[model samples]
Target chain A: EDQVTQSPEALRLQEGESSSLNCSYTVSGLRGLFWYRQDPGKGPEFLFTLYSAGEEKEKERLKATLTKKESFLHITAPKPEDSATYLCAVLSNQGGKLIFGQGTELSVKP
Target chain B: EAGVAQSPRYKIIEKRQSVAFWCNPISGHATLYWYQQILGQGPKLLIQFQNNGVVDDSQLPKDRFSAERLKGVDSTLKIQPAKLEDSAVYLCASSLTQGRFYNEQFFGPGTRLTVL
Candidate 1:
C-alpha cells in the first residue's frame, strides 16, 4: 500500500522564525513527491516536485528537499502571509495516483 | 492561460438532496482530475480522465456518484443523494499529460459543498 504521513499536524511560529515540515511516505515506487500550499476556502496550489534523493527546489522563502524515505519543506523567516496548509503527496508508480499526507497546518504570526 | 474554471463556488443543501458541479480544464490539457478535500485534510483523488476516456475511477463511490467528460474539455460530477459526510471542497485539476514524472497539475478555485 502507498501511504504518506506528515509530522506535527500543526505548527505555530512567530515572524522571522524558521521551521521544517516533514512528509514521510511508503510506496511501491516513488515516482515523484509533490508539495502544495492550500489556503482556507481555496484549492491547493502546486509548490515543488522532487523526483530523486538529494533533490531540492526553492521558491521565495520556501525550500523542499527529498530523500528516499521522506521529504521535508523548510521555511525561513516565515511571515503571516505564509500561513497555509502544506500538503505532501507521493505519486505512486503502481496506480499512477498521488497519495497525500494529512498536511501540516502552519500558522505564522507577526 | 486563464487556469481551470469551476462553477458554483459555494453550495449548501441538506442530506439526500442531489447536487452537481462542473469544471472546465485548461485548453489542450489531456488529463483532468477530480479531488475531494475535507476541512483540515489533504485532497484525495476521486477520479481521473485522459481526454474523453476514464483513466482511474476506482476510488469513486459508484452507488450514487457519477461523472462525465463528454467533450474531453469540460466535465461534471453528480451526486444523486448527498450525505452529511460529503461536505467538502471538490477540486478540479488538469495536466498536460498523464505521465507522473513530469506532470504538474493546475488546480481550480474548487466548489465548496456544505451538506447539512
Candidate 2:
C-alpha cells in the first residue's frame, strides 16, 4: 500500500534556528513529491514539487529535496511566520491522487 | 488569479443529519479534488474529477457521500446521515491538469464540519 510518513510530529525552535522535516514514503511508483505549508484555520498552501531523486527546489527560506524513498523540507533561520504545519504528499502512478503524510507541526518562538 | 473557493467556512450539525459543501476551482483548471481532513492529520482525498468526469472516488464512502461537478466547473459534495466520525474539515483543490508531469494543486480555505 502507498503511504507517507513524517517524523517529529511537533517541533519547537527559537527564532533563527534551522532544521529539516522528513517525509518517507512507500509507493508503487513515484511520480512526484509535494510540500505544503498550512496555517491555522486555512488550507494548505503549495510550496514545491520534486519530481526525481536528487531534485531540489527552493523559495526564500525554505528548500525541498527529494530522493527515491523520502523527501525533506529544510527551513533556514526560521522566523515566527515560518511556524506552520508542513505537509508532504506523493503522487503515484501518474494519477491525480495524492498520498499525504500526517504532517509536522513547527513552532518558532522569538 | 483567484484561488479555489469553498462555501460555508464552518457548519455544525447533528448525527444522522445531511449537509453539503461547495467548491469553485480556479478558472480554467482541468482537475478538481475534494478531501477530508481530520484534526491533526493530513487531508485525505475523497474524490477527484477531471473536466466533469470522475477520475477517482475510491476513498469516498459511497453509501453516504456523493459529489458532482457539472459543466466542469463548480462542484458539490454531500453527506447524508452524517456520523460523528464525519466531523472534519472539507477541503477543495484544483490543478491545471493531472498526469505524470508536474502539477501543483491550489487549495481553498476549507469548510470545518462539526457533528454532535
Candidate 3:
C-alpha cells in the first residue's frame, strides 16, 4: 500500500518565523515528489518537484528537500502572506498517480 | 495562458439528488485529472484522462460517479443519487503530459459540493 503522511497538522507561526513541514511516504516505486500551496477559496499552486533523493528546490522564501522516505518543506522567515496549507504528493511508477498527504495547515500571524 | 477552469464554485443539495461538475483544462494540455478533496485533507485523484482516453479511473466510485472527457478538451463528472459522504471539493487539474518526470499539474479553483 502506498501512503503519504504529513505531520504537524496545524502550525501557528509568528511573522518572520522559520519552520519546516514534513511529508513521509511509503510507495512501491517513487517517480516524483511534489509540493503545493493552497490558499483559502483558491486552488493549489505548484511549488516544486523533487525527482530523486538528495534533491532540493527553492523559491522566493521556500525550500524543499527530499530523502529516500520523506520530504521536507522549509519556510524561511515566513510572512503572513505566505500562510496557506502546504500539500505533499508522491507519484508512483506503478500507477502514475499521485498519492497525497493530509496537508499541513500553516498560519503566520502578523 | 489561462489555468484550468471549473464551473459552479459552490453547490448545495439534498442527498440522493444528482449533480454534475464541469472542467476545462489548460489549452493544449494532453492530460486531465479530476480530484476529490475533503476538508482538512489533500486532493485525491478520482480519474485521469489522456486525450479523451481513460488512463485511470480506479479510484472513482462507478456506482454513483461517472466522468467523460468529450473532444479531448472539456470534461464533465456526474454524481447520481449523491450521498452525504460525497460532500467535498471537486478539483480539476491538467498537465502537459503524463510523463514519468516533470509532470506538474495545474489546478482549478474547484467546485465545493455540500450534500445534506
Give the per-residue lDDT of model 3 (tens digit) for A1-110.
98999999999999998999999999998888999999998889999989899999999999999999999999999999998999999988887888899999999999
Per-residue lDDT over A22-87 for candidate 1, one digit per residue giving the tens place of the 0 to 100 score = 999999988899999988877789999998899999999999999999999999999999999999
A1-110 per-residue lDDT for model 2 (tens digits): 88999988999999999999999999888888899999999999999988889999999999999989999899999999999999999988745588899999999999
Model 3 interface RMSD, one decimal: 0.6
Model 1 residue pairs with clashes: none
| Residue-level error in angstroms, candidate 1, position B112 | 1.1
| lDDT of residue A73 for candidate 2 | 91
Off by over 4 Å in 1: none
Residue A88, candidate 2: Cα error in Å is 0.3
Candidates sorted by DockQ, descending order?
Answer: 3, 2, 1
DockQ, model 3, C-alpha based: 0.94
- DockQ-wise, the better of 1 and 2 is 2
Model 2, C-alpha of B102: deviation from truth (Å): 3.7
Residue A54 C-alpha lDDT in model 3: 99
